[model samples]
Target: MPPMPARIIHTSIARDWREVYAFMADHEKMPLWASGLSAGLTREGEEWLAPGPLGNARVRFSPDNDYGVVDHLVTLADGQQVHNALRVVPNGDGAEVMFTLLRLPGMSDAQFAEDAAWVEKDLASLKSILESSKA
Candidate 1:
């Protein structure tokens, strides 16, 4: 299949990249910033279970690493799996957190735009929380 269109939604936080990575990599803390996971996640073996838009979802996050990669796979109740690529990179004294949102198959342009906006809002929340924490 052809590659789906993608948008990189990101925000800059006035915090160390490693610190930001540590906070985001912890899936349990995601609901504080990631609105999609506002209901929070519960560990179930190697995967996590969360109340998703389409019912329950199984989430498997990447293992801990030196790099700031916090990628994860979310399996919907309908058996649809979505791969999310997220990263926190150093930007001078601050960090830039980015989330790649792919326009999935059969997704309308308006739906894709809305998804991008949602991601943007989440990233903004992350930036606010992290940056404010330093004060």
Candidate 2:
């Protein structure tokens, strides 16, 4: 059988999927929660340049969709592309947001685990931000 994604991290946000998707679907807003892009983003057409620990990197986020898909591909200064598969699904009155993290080449097992934790933290931040905004 084909291998599954190395890891899938997720969280259920208190806000409706519409609200969650409206926030997450904006690629330019990613740095607010995404640790890797703490310095935020600048865009030109389909390409987005986000400041990274190493340097500025280019990215391409999937176009907004009615179904709440928020995937993206990031290209570092070294020209390596990393695909991040993310989705938001309705769960009752709230939303379930999931992130699929793949094990890339040269990543150690521990590094993969750490990446999952990082995703969890980021998702939690997203949850906090969205839920708080309603206050």
Which candidate has the highest TM-score of all? 1
**TM-score (all chains, Cα) for each model:** 0.97, 0.92
- Collision pairs in model 2: none
Candidate 2: tens digits of C-alpha lDDT, residues 7-106: 7899999888998999897776788988878888998788999877787788898887999899989899898888889999999999999999998877
Q: Rate the local accuracy (lDDT) of all candidates.
A: 0.93, 0.87
Clashes (N, CA, C under 3 Å) per candidate: 0, 0
Q: How well is each residue in 1-135 modelled by candidate 1, as lDDT tens digits?
A: 899899988888899999999999988999999999999899999999999778999999999998899999999999999999999999999899999999999999999999998999899889889988952
lDDT of 1 at 2: 95
**Clash count (model 1, backbone only):** 0
Best by lDDT: 1
